[model samples]
Target: MFEFFPGDHVRSSSVNLALMAGGSLADIGRWLGPLRDTPEAGLDAWAAAWAGMAHQQEALAAGDVRAGYLAAAGRRYLRASVYHATAQRQIPPGPTKSESYAASLQAFGNAMDCGALPLVRVHVDSPDGTLPGYLIAPDAADPRPVVIVYGGLDLTKEMLYATVGAAFARRGITCLVIDTPGTGELIRLRGVPSRPDYEVPTAAIIDHLQARHDVDARHVAVLGVSFGGYYAARSAAFEPRVSACVSWAGSWDCGALWRRRWDEAEAEPTSWFLPWVTGTGTIEEALERLELWTLADVWPRVTQPLLIVHGENDREIPVADARRAFEAAGSADKRLHVFAAAGGGAEHIQSDDPAPALDLIAEWLSLRMPVLPEPPVPALA
Candidate 1:
């Protein structure tokens, strides 16, 4: 679906390895050394750099390494910068529960460089629906910050780790990426709709995260990506458990992405709108249903420090969304980092050259809320 050119796959493969294994991250990046010198790699790097996007629940509960890397080998057409320091999030045990279905998406993701964080999928009871989610944290970390990641529209939690999930892991935050109501298998296969109270299901995520001894009750955050970005911002507004919030290439509004991706103007899938989100409605009806989840009504609730990153030339969720979010976000520390414009910092997800975008995200989080290791003081001359 990314429809990337030749060398993009190679860089993606290496990055996948690095997202899952953070400290030795360069080991995976070393493969792209050849492309490092080429100009096309810069363009490829933008897409490849954000190859880590997605809300992975234990990468869906995640995907492969060797074969994917071998596949990306020797493609020298396109490459991009290797920036951003994201580590793999591991789960420690206390009250945390664990399980794995044969559904670990490694094979599907191996080729995609979508590193999954792995987790036991559990069904939580809610008034509107049964929220299904992955608890992606280790049970034994002395202390851990908990995160609940929401998936983008149509994409599954199993496959979105390369960017979103990997970003949080680098922060050493435990994450729970869920299928939620309107995204992924839940809506495509199951009959769920995007609810206005997205925080309702998210409460379950907080419950599961807090139940674990590995989680720090005081430091919970929500990082919503793509479609989930809007919902997460709204959720942090009411859910005190969410100590901080971020929406990457987030949606200030919804339904618009669906229209661009699925409206008659665009190529429609075999199933126009899945039963869960539309539930036997016409496209117009589907649009109406999703309206229930739009951020137009909910943005006011979000009060936490908000960070929104959007591509200046973004065709899907216009940069206007970021502008609106920056204005509407009640957080005094709110920020908007617009990618240059595909050539430099402004590509979608910084897809043309991710170095600037990736670094900006790391730096922003470091300032607002992060648990950093003490830096060694320079020796006195």
Candidate 2:
């Protein structure tokens, strides 16, 4: 990954994430330029810098809207949304984080409206509550294969949509980017904690999708990124509705990973991140809760077609997790692809360079899911 913050791995990863979410190099330079030498600058300073840029983009979007340049306005709003979301990632859970999250959602909605994007805000009824998500479907009227994407750790559905969801849509597949429990809106706004039995929510999401006319219910797939790799695999193991599963940077034992991090005194982007997402008061509590998050038993139950993609130089989760998942999976048809450090996507989830990984995933899904053919044009022109 590009180290915009030099020695700061946390901030550097954040920069890579922003870039993956459509942030420009010039804008990133402008935002982090002043803080380059300020070693003492903390999370507040980082949040402020990104928030300032977000406000600027929001203002530009408003001006574009006033001039009736909807497309231009939409582009600005999208950037603004990304900036706001990025800003909130640095802050601890509180009123400030809530405000920033709300702003990001609003900006993203405006972007969709102004751009006339083929996306819809969806709410799937789950055992916990109504799970919030954004669905992007192809322009075609025919039913298409659908992939339910769940983000990990601090990632939101909006960020996933901007990075991964749209790519699937372009390939004629319907994509549902969900803010699953323990991540994004659920944990941030609703205080819904992460759960080990992800299949419950996954089933609910599939139930909702099956009701949609635009979706091919039989071809439903589940994909999870970063820490979400466990969620996707676990869901696929139990949920028979899921036709295929993709673990983007698979996690074999997240609890073990957290314990290792704790032992090593690893540096985290924010102190509150894990605790907040896990719905715990401290790191120790979060680690204890995460003990049930392992896929040691879950992997053996996944009989569906499975794809495990891991970065050879992934700084967060070791590539060994991917191998473990691949070896343990009960699926007769399972493949593991590891991007080497020499290549671009050697970092977590291919954040260093996401295009190739995204392409590989799309192609893999296309072969498995098989997108429906579009309706023929009428003879009378």
Candidate 3:
């Protein structure tokens, strides 16, 4: 709700989100240099600025790849993907939205293809069709623990990897970044709606992981962001195979939040996003569908180790939700960490800078995951 652009909360938040999703300060400066001072910036203006920057990056990325500059190409492609995603979020579900989303996915694919890391595209069969996923291994030769990461609400799978999945991989953890039902390609392309029973998809993901020889199924974990916090908690509560769980923002009772937001009547972009994700035609219908999103009944069922991380200044989901979820969980090994402004993680998911939060999550998961064998010491002969 805080506005960096005087009266434009949406534009301001979009800029912050773009940076959080891996946009560079230089890119932001170039994109917003002209429009930041202009009054009454509309959505079209917002989309156009980001889209123009994204196209330029994409072109440079292609040229870099052709010139055998793989690393440079990867970085440019990643930036372009984030910019396209930012532009797509500003627009609604229409041709322009679809076009930007497609461009974002394509750029992400190009980034992966540049071989910056060993990221492979995976598709899991679901009732709706195939769910797109990216499988990144910490080491191809070793069997490592995997974390299935998904985004909340409007987040795309590319943004999830840009923010968290890459960090996990760097810390010796395998990551499966998926566009689950009701999100990303599933919603924008296949028309899948939000399901309270996230374990259904979680089960499919576990099955996919188990079938792979590189994964240590015994230590598999699920982590979710924003509204996805609710999905991860629900899956951990019901799915016996999930060894651990993390609620990035701790969505204990999303239905209650919906009710409150509806009554408040500000009608942010989410007022449209919620219904679209839930496959409802209106907010009233979406709220009715969201009745199943509460975690009151599910908390007692979570027997695995649980981690709840919340921001002290989180305006969307209050820090109290983390406390409530932690208290209700049956996990004896549960822990609650509230990052305050002093620690640089007080913002939601540590958007101002994700390093601290990513480091915390990676360290936490490292301790719980199956240990890998250490390298042999070289002989001094």
Give the winner by lDDT.
Answer: 2
Which segments of model 2 are wrong by more than 4 Å?
267-269, 373-381
Give residue 322's error in model 1 in angstroms: 1.6
Regarding TM-score, does 1 or 3 come out ahead? 3
Q: Show where candidate 1 strays beyond 4 Å.
A: 1-140, 164-166, 255-264, 267-271, 274-276, 342-347, 351-359, 370-381
TM-scores for the candidates: 0.62, 0.95, 0.93
Ranking by lDDT, best first? 2, 3, 1
**Count of backbone clashes for each model?**
40, 0, 0
lDDT of 3 by residue, 7-111 (tens): 665576677778877787788788777787876667778788889999999999889988999999998999999999989886778988998999998888888
lDDT at 281, model 2? 93
TM-score of 1: 0.62
lDDT of each: 0.53, 0.87, 0.83
Worst 10 residues of 1 by lDDT: 74-83
